[model samples]
Target: MANPPLTPEDQERYQARLQALIVEHRDLDQVISHLAENPPPDQLLVPRLKKRKLQLRDQIWEVEALLMPDEPA
Candidate 1:
């Protein structure tokens, strides 16, 4: 079954969430890079940060897909 279209308010909320997730993902990338450069990086923390970043990326993709679904051929 087709999903119902999002209301204007829902669209706005989704956009806001998507932006926030993108920002968080970018921030995590910076932190991860910095940590890798610094001597004796916390092996545990680095992996956790990377995992979170991947989760955020997945969320961003989901929101984007909801906002603009692919058209059928």
Candidate 2:
């Protein structure tokens, strides 16, 4: 689906939200990497991180879908 162009205010808001999401995704990815290196882990963090990562991935996909106006569906 082609995305419509955003107004200036909407673009600013979208950029801010996208930046925050990218930071969150990076933080979760780092936690997952750190967990892989350590032994005797809490065991719960992996699933949580994986779940968060999936959620963030979906959000990223949605955002990219919105950003790419001319992309083919």
Candidate 3:
């Protein structure tokens, strides 16, 4: 089912949240890269970080869809 359209306040909130998620995702990418390069990275930590990054990406996509939903033809 289609979700109800967001009000102006809700849209603003979502935009803020999306921006924060994007920043966090970028930061995680940098950390993951650094960890991979620094010798003998913790096996457990890297995987966990990668997983979190994926989750963040999913969340960002969801918020974007909410903020800018597609129109029907």
**Tens-digit lDDT track for model 2 on 5-67?**
778887778778888899999998988888888833577878888899999989987776666
- Candidate 1 vs candidate 2: the lDDT winner is 1
Per-residue lDDT for 26 in model 2?
A: 96
Superposed model 1: Cα runs more than 4 Å off = 39-41, 69-73
**1-73, model 1: which lDDT tens digit per residue?**
5556888998899999999999999999999898889834456998899999999999999899887745663
Q: Candidate 2: where is the Cα deviation over 4 Å?
A: 39-41, 71-73
Cα RMSDs of all predictions? 2.4, 2.9, 2.0
Q: For model 3, how does the per-residue alpha-carbon lDDT over 5-63 read when each residue is reduced to its tens digit? A: 88999999999999999999999999999888884445799889999999999999999
Model 1 poorest 10 in a row by lDDT: 64-73
TM-score of each: 0.87, 0.79, 0.87
Cα RMSD for candidate 3?
Answer: 2.0
The lDDT for every candidate, in the order shown, is: 0.89, 0.81, 0.90
Q: For each predicted model, how many residue pairs clash, with residues at least 3 apart or on different chains?
A: 0, 0, 0
